[model samples]
Target chain A: MSQTFSLAIDAMGGDNAPDIVLDGLELAAERHPKARFLLIGDEARIGAMLARRPRAAKLCMLRHAPGVISAEMKPTAALRQGRNSSMRLAIDAVASGEASGVVSAGNTGALMALAKIVVKTLPEIDRPALAAITPSARGDVVMLDLGANVQCDARNLVEFAVMGDTFARAVLGLTAPSFGLLNVGSEELKGDERVRQAAEVLRESHIGPNFHGFIEGHDIAAGTVDVVVTDGFTGNVALKTGEGALKLMRDLLRQVFTSSVPARMGYLLARPALDRLREWMDPRRYNGAILLGLNGVVVKSHGGTDATGFAHAVDVAMDMVTHRFNDRIREGLSMLSTPARVPVPATAPR
Target chain B: MSQTFSLAIDAMGGDNAPDIVLDGLELAAERHPKARFLLIGDEARIGAMLARRPRAAKLCMLRHAPGVISAEMKPTAALRQGRNSSMRLAIDAVASGEASGVVSAGNTGALMALAKIVVKTLPEIDRPALAAITPSARGDVVMLDLGANVQCDARNLVEFAVMGDTFARAVLGLTAPSFGLLNVGSEELKGDERVRQAAEVLRESHIGPNFHGFIEGHDIAAGTVDVVVTDGFTGNVALKTGEGALKLMRDLLRQVFTSSVPARMGYLLARPALDRLREWMDPRRYNGAILLGLNGVVVKSHGGTDATGFAHAVDVAMDMVTHRFNDRIREGLSMLSTPARVPVPATAPR
Candidate 1:
């Protein structure tokens, strides 16, 4: 089966649905060349929106989805009853093997609930994670459990660490990626018992000390590690804090830049550099929140994400398909079962 | 009622203790003309080191304490066996009402454990929070539960918010302190059952909505709210992560600044601007963790804090002294008794 024309997008989801979704899909189609999208939304509305735009030749035909999942709807009801809801329908397409992967900008709760119940996890995979790209000091940091599972067990964290490592390797193209635990301190035994136990499991596992042990929020921007692992609760806080902080700084910078004529002049002179800095720090750079440890890849974009962000998500999906990330995760798990494994050299970043 | 002329330093704690501890205290004393110290350690070694330095006045006099508290020492054991230890003597000076406040560069567990037993918390206060200053996008952001309690409860959170608010208003001088529960989302229903309950208590409490409401980790740095509150466990994690991310950024910026010839040239020209930015982002600017809800003001500085960091801590102490912060906290709590009477401003950074 040709896996080229993949990605089933939850077109009816997000704040600016169908319009932004279609725009993202169209741009992604142009960028990927090989990729096509199955837009899940009301056929008439989607078609109307499409007609207004100079449609890309690669735009996949619209797939009518009967209902739109309200962002505020309860996840339980949304998952159980949202059969025709665009988000659910998108997931259904993936579940039924009509699409290679799925992307949603709907309520995270509903998406997680539906994906876990329908798309399901691979054998021995107890839970899935909401992994987002965090701004680290060095580069982008992949933070897991942005808000999926609140209560985490040691085994779950280990799985998260492993899954995050795989995602980093596949998407970021960093082989033998460095992993760090989100903790209060860098030293061993500095965090809660659960974190401490997870650290031990990570250390003893084949992952080795590329497992850089404990990391704090300050380290998030340091880029000391490729992947930072934690429970959904903590990771959600960290991710939001990072995003909020970046936005806040930019806002403050703008305020200061516009405070006085001299400052404004300085800002103008430094516009290119500042723009580069802002662009680098912008949340749009890392738009996709990929849910890992499942049979198929699932990427969640922000509800307010625009076409640019959507295009990035699609690119991430393409990378997922090209790298066969899920297979690598399965293979990594299998390698754990077999002892005395040969050392794998780290995958350097592209 | 008389405070001591000198203090006993905890020569060991954190990753860069003893050495950094000595350097920091020495620097603090030199900078502050009124400051004096009583170094607690091996008399011979401390004396020898002191002799090597040019001394004017009895600035830092050594006080011998044979045993040391290891950073890994269990809290209970540290308290039990530390009767004659350096930490206790320092606290003893305070319990005996000799020193105004004690400073330690030793294990946090031991310090807090000793502090609770000796200094004790204020009446009506359920627990004391390890409150500290965080550099937000705009300015200083106050957070609590930096490293005290672990298992979180709604009541505990209520106390944290109340005390954290007072701390912010008194310490940071914000018009009306923002109070927020560091949870998964800004919405009232976000996070675990405990967090949901806490959010309600916070929302309906005398603290008004302008007092700010539920804040996520992202809100901490986003500068939307002035104060971010959580249990020690979560707060501790956020604090560390923030610190780690900042350090990572600093290190990475250094790398980027010296990456190539053009970069090096830019660094030279932009040195002044970059220096200004670094100062604005300096962790030291917002240093010192306040053990709030306690009877007396107590600040926990980085055991490895340099002179600059220590000065920040001293400033925090001075601010507390000047603002009568403890009294304000008590007043804030007492106001809670007349439920329908007063309004406590909720200033949560969103």
Candidate 2:
């Protein structure tokens, strides 16, 4: 536990709202007893929930916010009408230097929009990327632009590489994490000009020794490198596609274990190992999406996630705060040379 | 089996070459006894292998092709230097009307480049798309543009919809296949201009009744639609990412079951069910990548696959030929109004 650390919590976000948010804090507080929280939401509801959890209530400083950003609200609308929203106030705490970071399980678009406008991005960063830590065959891999900038130029992609590199080192505990640019194919001449130019910049950068060249989609789960970087469109698609595949497997396995009496008996015998497997593959273990290149750390937890998942998101925000993630990014960016200008084609190459 | 149906075979394409090709023919021949093959490769090697399977040998006509396209060869280079290649000859047979279709397990880029040039595309089709039938929760899902055209305009996407619709009906035996345009989100305004315009066109076309609107990446495995349409880059990445996720699941399951003695016993008891699950998930059963919008049926098998997988590719080609896939596509295209000219943005939208 970091004795001086504190984080802002958006208590009114997510499906379960104040209940799960308070419950999550109770769990997180047990793990990091010294850390404090500035809980921003409806004071009455939060206070009632906090009363039920005495320890979490003792550690939380409740602040009243009259509005909440609905999950279905558009980013532009949220920005225009969300002055006193819990999500906004929580992020403001980080910008006002009251907290080291902010965590929310609210509307993704709203959170991202507010974070960008309120905390703003680093001076060297053009756009912040959404990075997630996913379990891979080798270990954990950090992938960026999970759903941030849908369209990216070579400069944007190069910036993501630097941020993702810094992220892997801080969170995954990798000393020199190898990163790869995600493309349709691993060849030097496979994708569009933007991808090729990003590869070229990385190849010539100070961190070139840590660059693993281009890698295909399959390399993500294979853990071909420590960081996998791509534009939000492909990265988002790839992320959801992976989730879909995993769900399909789970469904198929359920059918298999229930097909016969022998399978039922086998299920009993294998229950322990199966339990371990479930724990290993649990979504809660990797619940947070860190918005990189932002001036302050902002972690987005899945809106539908339970208390356990929310706790994991809190853990991610704490990790960044304790590790000085922003300082490292600034250092990394300062050490790099700007990528050469390459005219990207209007359309993708054949 | 249609007695008149004969598929041109690239006998020296895959990793195993003539031996696997001949062996695959033997297996495929059993499933379609009336079908004949025009096998193209080194005569002596194919002949010697064909001799081992007398039944297959009797049904095959061997053609000599001294060259082979290496996996690493670029598409342009392959077309330039691989004129006498087995892959090229097989595609040539289709163009010359000597064979109903062509099946190749060669380099994907080379196979695609040659097929597009020699066999040509449908008169109304602007670009050919690679289609694959993947197993899903509800049943099999047909997805297209899996690396055929890197970037696609709205017109290109509309064509893919028509072709994908026909492909699902022919291969999956669906009477009316519902199709969805793949995008980052399900909202009409979620993705770039190309996707929205494609959706608009589909909304007004003859197939509008069958169009299910925009779907996210998870919809591919959810089997929300019978056909999933996307540009080549996203589709290809999604396909490989699914494969990677499945592989990760398998590795994790193995570790889970083998962790303890009870788990091992349970695995044995569940062995029958597990085997069935494995069979259902086997890559060989879904090995072919059909190049849709082509004038003739063309199937690309995995270059590293064995006889069983190759046979599956042949089975796919046979399905297309028997169903008159090209004619169906022409009919589908003729029934629809041309896509309205909507300006597609150069890159995916934020």
Candidate 3:
């Protein structure tokens, strides 16, 4: 805690750009006084914003980048032409060890592609996955592969489980977090072959004691486990579905509260309780989507998030860097690779 | 409309068993006065329950079923051992022409397996899909392949689209419904090869005009399309995720409303408006899951649902039977199989 660490910030990313980025940095700086930031963007614009925020200015070292990745740009296009882009420069900072981690709110696909090529994945992982903290009935749950790989084999899924376990330990502060493989049903023969194979391997591996077996979609919100792992396609769909459902309920609640005069008065009386509920369910509290299995930490903030949400993303990056998330993943993978010890026979000599 | 049709009911299915089944039958009978029911279960129990409901007794024909399929029994095990089970006999009634359709609140897997073998599939259909009506922001949305086939190829997806289209027309009363293939993103290249291939085929088929291309998980609740189509694995997960999210919101709302005296009074004043919201969001309104692509209509009710929910399942069955769902599917498939008409050049001979 005594040593200062630096995080690379993509100042030109997100909907609000350098303004919110700088404001978020000021807030993050206040929280982590020992943390320094390498702000990567157009130097002139970033320098102007830093002048207004004394706290962020005191801790920031600005770096110039001329280009920005648009949300609609294809990953391939971004990779080909976004060499001097703020996102690329920020990731480069992590790869070159100029910073311990990088945080961006730009296009997700572009970030994943650029980060994989520049910062590289851990040697033990076949493919890196997108992991995010989602609100559940019991508390927050970690789910992986929100949309990194369109299709995955059994090996990729097993790797996701390992990353998810380390992620829960590092970020959620759970020592022995239970995890489940997402599937159609909890039965042994329910999902596709890939999922079944993954379950089998997890059951026999070192982390088998914490594996809760196959879980269905509802289990995500039910907080059936601390971590949920699946192929990118299914995981992405489930995450979005949950978001959409929550949005629908919120909209309906608003409609109900404004339906009549009685309802309006009731809303006034219930405002405090409802406010507590709203705060508990706020999307800003769970803004960061960490791309796990990378050699260095990478957190992707929601593109539309404001200063507070962006600051939460920085907090996630700081936690990962300080907790040595990648080191834990390395240890977990080694444990997985080691075969289970067989019990010695009583008749045989020890 | 002039002819009376009989529906076979599995009296021993569901958590409540013969009691709710008969009560639901009485309600269904009141709605469809001309309809008759072949109540298949333990004759004595069904007869005893029917005695309490005069309307259901007047319209029901009691048939003895010696066995019942447990919810936890596997599909294959049920197939081999459930010959005289209420669920199997109800399906047999449809196959034997004793009833126009079959409705069960039994084990979904058993119902699907038995219905597929007994009722058989439409000649043009390669695989039958589990289609259900889900509540969406715009209204009711039809989603297919809820969990019939865990692994589906492009062909299966294309067929599901055809079935979904007919299902929307027959059950939801939509003349032309917009349908989309569910994926990770809305882009053409966002999903796996199977989805892209299916999209290509759908784009060129007869339903091309109504095809909405690729949609993400959020689109299901957004009602971006009238029908949401996907492989069983993803579709099932998405469905349950949506359900889970809604449940979470409802639970939170209740906790907020009862958190204190002021909140409790607020609940009383808002009771009417909240009741309307509850009705609109009620899972019972959308209880039936239809097994589409089969020769005869088959509806599965939620096992834990009460009498009112069971009645909704019977209503769905009646709608499919009256609308001739399979016949429409046949027409749609024939159109798909027949190549699109080619436009001749004006300069060339026609």
Best by TM-score: 2
* Candidate 3: tens digits of C-alpha lDDT, residues A293-329: 9888999999999999999999999999989888999
Q: Candidate 1 chain B: worst 10 consecutive residues by lDDT?
A: B341-350
lDDT of predicted model 3 = 0.88
How high is the TM-score of chain A in each model? 0.93, 0.95, 0.94
User: Which is the better candidate, 1 or 3, if ranked by lDDT?
Assistant: 3
Clash counts per candidate, in order, are: 41, 0, 0
Number of colliding residue pairs in model 3: 0
Q: TM-scores of all models?
A: 0.84, 0.96, 0.95
Q: Model 2: residues >4 Å from true position, as ranges?
A: A1-5, A338-350, B1-5, B338-350
lDDT of 2 by residue, B1-350 (tens): 23343799999998988778888999998998888889999997778888889878877899999999999999999989999999999988888888989999999999999999998988878899999988788889999889998777787898899999999999999998999998888877687777887888889898899999998888888899999999888899899988898889888888878988999999999999998888888889989999998878899999889999999999999999889889999999888864433433343422
RMSD of 1: 6.1
Give the true-contact fraction for every prediction, in order. 0.46, 0.75, 0.84
Q: Write the per-residue lDDT of candidate 2 for residues A1-350, one digit (tens) a residue.
A: 23223799999999999788889999998887878899999998888889889878878889999999999999999999998999999988888878889999999989999999999999988789999988788988999888787777787888899999999999999999999998888989997777887888888887899999998888988999999999888888888888888889988888889999999999999998888777777888989999999878999999999999999999999889889999999999887864432332343312
What's the distance in Å from true for residue A151, model 1?
A: 1.5
lDDT (CA) per prediction:
0.72, 0.88, 0.88
**Candidate 3, which CAPRI tier?**
acceptable
Q: Tell me the lDDT of model 1 at B252.
A: 50
- Which of the predicted structures, 1 or 2, would earn the higher TM-score when compared with the native? 2
Q: Report DockQ per prediction, comma-separated.
A: 0.32, 0.62, 0.49
